[model samples]
Target: MTVTEISRLALYGYQIPLNPPLPVGRQRITSRHGLLLRAITDQGEAVVELAPLSGTDMDGEPIDGFSRESLQQLQDELTTLQPQLGSTAALERAAGQTALPSLAWGLGLLALKLEGQLTSRQPRLAPVPLIYRLPNETADELVQRLATLPRDCRFAKLKIAQNDVEAELRLIYALLAARPDVRLRLDANGGFSLTQAVDFCACLPKGSIDFIEDPCRESADCEALHSALGLGYALDAPLNAPDFELSPLPGLRALVLKPMLIGSPAKVQALIAAAQQLGVRCIISSALESSLGISDLAAFAAQETPDEAPGLDTLAAFEADLLVSSGKALCLELGQLPLLASWEAGC
Candidate 1:
C-alpha cells in the first residue's frame, strides 16, 4: 500500500478579533484564537486549521458547548506530535490515537490534501444556497436587517432559549410579519428541557418554522420534543456524541455537520451517506472558524452537499482576515497567517 508523504510543514498561531464579539451558548467572545497548518507534499501545497470552539464566562466556568476539548488541550496534543509531524505515517498514527475531533480532523484533512483526494477534482465554485443568521436586534432593527438581505436569500436562523421566551415569540411574529417570504430556522442550542421545549413550540404558530435545531440537551428529549410538536428538528451536538448512531426518527429532518467538531473526513462522509440513505438532509455548518477555515468549509460544502444551503454566515463576525482580505466572499484559497513554527523532513 502506498502512503502519503509530507516533506515540509509549518504552524501558525492566530488571534483574530471578532467585531462586536460573538456569542455562543452562555459566553461572549471578543476574539478567536487557534492554529493553522501549512504543508508541502508530493501533490502540492495544502493548508488546514485547528480552531476548537470553547465558551467560558468571565469567571471561567467552562461553558464550552461546541468543542469536546479545550484549545489548550489541542495545543498540548500538537506539541507532543510536533517532532514527527512531517511524516505522514506519524500523522496517521496520532490521528488514530487522539480523541479530540479537531486534531483528528486536521490530521485527516492533511492526509487527504497530500493525496490530492479533495477539491482538485471537485468543482471550484458550486452555487450552493445560503442561510443568513439574523443578529440579535429589536423588532425595528430586525425588520431593517431583513430588508437588506440579498434577493436570493430566503432562509434565516435565529438563536433562541437565551432570553425571554415571550419576547422572542413576539419578535419572531413581528419579523415574519415584516417579511413573510422568509422561512425561519430556530436554534435553541439544547438549552431547554423536554417540557420547556414543548411549551415553547406550542406558542409558535403552526407551519411558521422550517425546523428547530438542538432544542434540548438530550437526543432522546429532542426526539420526544419533535414527537410532541410534530415539528422538524436538526441534530447538532448529538453528531459529536461518543455513541452517536444514525437511525430513523419520525421528525428528524437534518444533521448539522460541523467538520471541526466531527472526527475525521472519512467519518464525515460516512455520516453523510447514512443520513442521506435515511432521507435526512445534511447541512454543512461552521464553528466560527477564520476566513481560511471558512473557505475550506465552503469547498467542502460544495463537494458534499451541493444542493443544500449551508450555515456559513459567521464570517462577518471576524474583525480582520487571515490569509485573504476580510471582506471577500467564501472561496477555496489559503492565505498567510502568523507563523509559529516551521519544519522540513530532513532539515
Candidate 2:
C-alpha cells in the first residue's frame, strides 16, 4: 500500500454572506459557514480539503455541528493523527479503518483527488437533475411559486411540517392538479405521532404521492406507518446514525445521504453499495453545504452513481461561486494545485 506523510495541516473558517437569512426548522441562517482544510505532505504535495458545516441538532447551531467553538477540538483531534500519517496507509487501504469521521472524510477526499491525479482517471462531472424546491406555504401560494419553475422540471420536493395536515394535503393535490407530470417528495421532519402519521397517510390517494419522509421520530413508527399505508416513505436524518445499518422498512423509498455530516467518502460509497444491493435508491442530498462540499458531493456522485439527480440544487443560495461550473456540473477550483486539479476530478 502506498503511504503518504502528512507534514502539515491548516484549517480555515469561511463564511458566505446571505442576502436574506435562510431558515431551517425554527432558526434563521444569515451566512454559510465551513472549514477549508489544507494538508501538506512530506512529498511537497498540498491537497485542499473542504468540509462544510451543516445540520444543527438545535435550530441555532452551525451547519454539520462543526462550529467555530469546535475548531480547537478538531485541531486537537487532527493533531493526534499526525503520527498516523508519518506511517499511514494510502486512503484506499485504510478507508474502512478510519476512526475520526470528519478527518477521515477530508483526508479520503484529498486522497481521491490525488489518486485521480496519479492514475490519470480523474473524476468526471455530469449534469445532476435538480428537484424544484417548494416552500411550506398555502395552497394558492404554493401553486403560484411552482409556476415559476423552469420548463424542463419534472421532479419537485416540498417541505411540509404537518401542522395543518388537511391544508398540506390539499396543497399536494393542488400542486398535482397544476403540474401532474411532476413527481413529489415530502419531508415532514418527524412531525406526527404514529397514529397521526397513519391517519395522514390514509388521507392521500395510494398512487399519488412519491415519498413521504420522517413522519414520526421513531423508526418503528415510520415502519409501521409504511406497512399500514402501503405508501413509500423515506428516512432522511437517520441516515447519519453511527455505523448506520439498513432498517428495511416495508415501504422504504430512498436513503438520503448528506456527505458532510455522513463524514467519510468511503462510508458514503459503502452505503451506496448497500442501497444498490437492496434495490433502494440512494439520494445524495445536501444539508445546505457550500459549493466546496457540494463539489465534493458532485465528484463522489459522478463516479459512484451519476444517474440519480441528487438533492443538490443550492448554488443560487450562495453569495459567491466557490466552485467553477462546466455545463451543469460543479467542480473544485484549487489555485495552489493545478488549474487541472480543480477540473481533474470533474474531467
What TM-score would you give candidate 2 relative to the actual structure? 0.77
Candidate 2 residue-wise lDDT, 72-119, digit = tens: 454565555444443234444344464545555676776766444323
| CA lDDT, every model vs. true structure | 0.75, 0.61
- For model 2, the superposed segments whose C-alpha errors exceed 4 Å read 1-8, 23-27, 40-71, 86-100, 117-141, 323-347
Candidate 1 local lDDT, 1-347, one digit each (tens): 14666788777777777666676664667778888878887767777889888746435666576787887787777767767676666666677678998888888777766665566332233322233233565567866777667666667788888878998888788768876877788888888888999999999865778789998877788778877878889999889875688999889999999989987777788899999999999988888888777777777787888877788778776877767455654332334445677777535
lDDT of 2: 0.61
Query: Which numbered prediction scores highest in lDDT against the true structure?
Result: 1
Model 2 Cα displacement at 308 (Å)? Answer: 1.4
- Positional deviation of residue 122's Cα in model 2 after best superposition, in angstroms: 12
Clashing pairs in 2: 53-63, 53-64, 54-63, 54-64, 55-64, 123-345
